[model samples]
Target: MKYEGKIVLVTGARRGVGRLLAEHFLNQGAQVIGFSRHEDDEAQLPGYTPLAVDVGDPESVARGFEQVRKQFGRVDIVINNAAVLTSQYAMIMPAGAAKGMLDANILGTFLVSREAAKLMRKSKWGRIINIGSMAASLEPMGDSIYAATKAAIATLANVMAKEFAALNITCNTLGITAIETDMLGQLPKDKIDAVIAGLPLPRYATAEDIFNVVDFFASERSGYVTAQTVFLGGVN
Candidate 1:
């Protein structure tokens, strides 16, 4: 139980990678708080607390953390996993769609990390893991906005690592390639196949693969591992 008695907050925890991470933390004896746009019944599981929040909204995020303070007192780990992937070429991307991605993917991550850091600073120990995408560096077609948003996240992690270092809090970005999730399902079969063909590995990454890296960052051993971007797909 590496995370025994720790408090972990996972955004987008209703499904996909976020849900898997929340469950894993709970199994490791950590108190898990889930922040999602909608309520999830699975959060009823022992040691899991669900918070309905729109991470893009400052008021909503503030309210969510307020509840966390009321119930848990502090946050030990924050997994900024809530994001939206919109595929469109730069020229054809809609203005509204671009703004939406910026709000949910960039601003959302910033808000959660900002609030969580306050709680973590009190304890002088915390791990901030920002989920990123290989598309940022890969420059895949039809993902200009999505890739840009992830690129911003990687940059944010780098700067935050330095800003929060004195408080003993570490920030790192985990950039993953294609994974089996709803985000992948949105892509055309041809596009998905092309991504797989480009990967050096035979299979795409899994929720467990992402979890393994996150678990490492959550441990005491990774106290010095900050300002780094770790890619899981073996592409780079």
Candidate 2:
């Protein structure tokens, strides 16, 4: 769909993949609202509003949406991209890290999607696209909590799709493979390389690769597409 007049919200918009998505939509003429836990210093572009929000916190999410409601009144698309990933064996993972993943990866997506849906229902047409991970289906070792959270998001989207069908809001997930982002930089290079080598498409996903799928999900033509998880690099 044309983003010329669409109102788009993207979580985790301070950096990496989320920032990329936000900027792309903004360039397409959408009025973009970006949520980041960090201060809103990076995005000063026209038609872009950066908000400080911790998606896992109910109050923060609520306040962020309130700002959007006052400023834009409705949302046309939402990208649930805020997440925390800890790649340690479950036995060795700290409780704090596990809880962080649960809060940010699962709870964050849940909060943002629901809040965005509220704004969307006003318009009676909306797209809720979740940013998921290959870890969800790959189930690699050393990512038990992280993987579980990603998997949970896909399931969350599935049920939401059913509930929101009549409202014209379609929910879906894009479980992307590794990309050269800060998130991937946190992992062990050798291990990541080995994992990529095993994939049918053994390469890092590019920005365009991600945009293609996101655009698909955000398209008006995809009204019938909901409750689906599309994984990249043949991971699914």
- TM-score of every prediction relative to native: 0.97, 0.98
Q: Where does the lowest 10-residue lDDT sum fall in candidate 1?
A: 194-203
Query: How does candidate 2 fare on TM-score?
Result: 0.98
Per-residue error (Å), model 1, residue 225: 0.7
**Model 2 lDDT per residue over 27-127, tens place:** 88899999999888967899999999999898998998899889899999999999998899878999999999899989889988898888788779999
* Predicted model with the maximum lDDT: 2
Q: Which candidate number maximizes TM-score?
A: 2
Clash count (model 2, backbone only) = 0
State residue 218's C-alpha deviation in candidate 1, in Å: 1.0
RMSD of each: 1.1, 0.9
In order, candidate lDDTs are: 0.90, 0.92
